[model samples]
Target: MDLIRDDDENNSISANPPEGYVEPGWPALYSALHQDPQYLYQPYAIWRFTLYWTLLFYGFVFLVTGLLLLLNFTKRHPRLALLSFALWILSSLLLGLISSTIVAYALAALYNAAFLRMSTWVPPLWGAVQVLLLIFSAAANVPFFTG
Candidate 1:
């Protein structure tokens, strides 16, 4: 079935807009009007990129656990093994969040430059949620330590 029908024209060549023609910007109430096309695509790209990182982090955790299991760390030096395992998880979580934030922002900037009229909410919103979670987790850990 033909989805995009151009009944009038024999040639299927789509007419290109003028060199600087900007598409209508997304009607995002919370977002400002983007100056460049790239801005429009940033939020969506960041959202997608962060999701990939999530999977990557999970895979990394699994790989670490597998390696640790093979080494039988839990069977010997149990306390040290537990400490190392906890540290590894904590470090990986922090590293993933930190790297995701940095890359998302950087790529969002690049997207903003390359695309027009894209929504700019998803990236910031997701990033905010992550930051909040990180803060909450850190706060919960504070009571266990003494200066």
Candidate 2:
């Protein structure tokens, strides 16, 4: 008795896929792999995902700083505060987003290659770098600090 079917119509798992069936590319493959429960449960995957969230949280830091400036300085020097806020948005926020994106992608790659134990420090190190950037950017734009 024949174990394998040679007829293409009868065979469900054919050696050659039908026309117009495009194989998933690297981004699709990575997306599927990242969604897998087993892959997500791994320590490296956890840290890699966490790095993305950490970047988002850093963005919130800028938001809070802008809010605080509006609340405090609006009463005394509204125009100066508004200009400072605009400058902060143009300089600090844009710089932070660009820098964070680069760092986050780099850190995710590192997390993929690093051992679980070594990967633990990636988020904190990223946080420290962001904090320094935040300080410098704020000082460069803020009226009091610039003076």
Which candidate has the top score in TM-score?
A: 1
Q: What lDDT score goes with residue 125 in model 1?
A: 53
Clash count, one per candidate: 9, 0
Error of 1 at 80 (Å): 1.5
RMSD of 1: 12.9
lDDT tens per residue, model 1, 1-147: 643322324422122223453433333225245553232333544545464544364446545664675468877777877777777666666666665767676656654454333344544455445545655676678966534
Displacement of residue 134 (Cα, Å) in model 1 is: 22
Instruction: Compute the lDDT for candidate 2.
Output: 0.53
Clashing pairs in 2: none
TM-score for candidate 1: 0.42
lDDT of 2 by residue, 2-61 (tens): 443334455332233345544332122233346531122133343444455445555567
| Candidate with best lDDT | 2
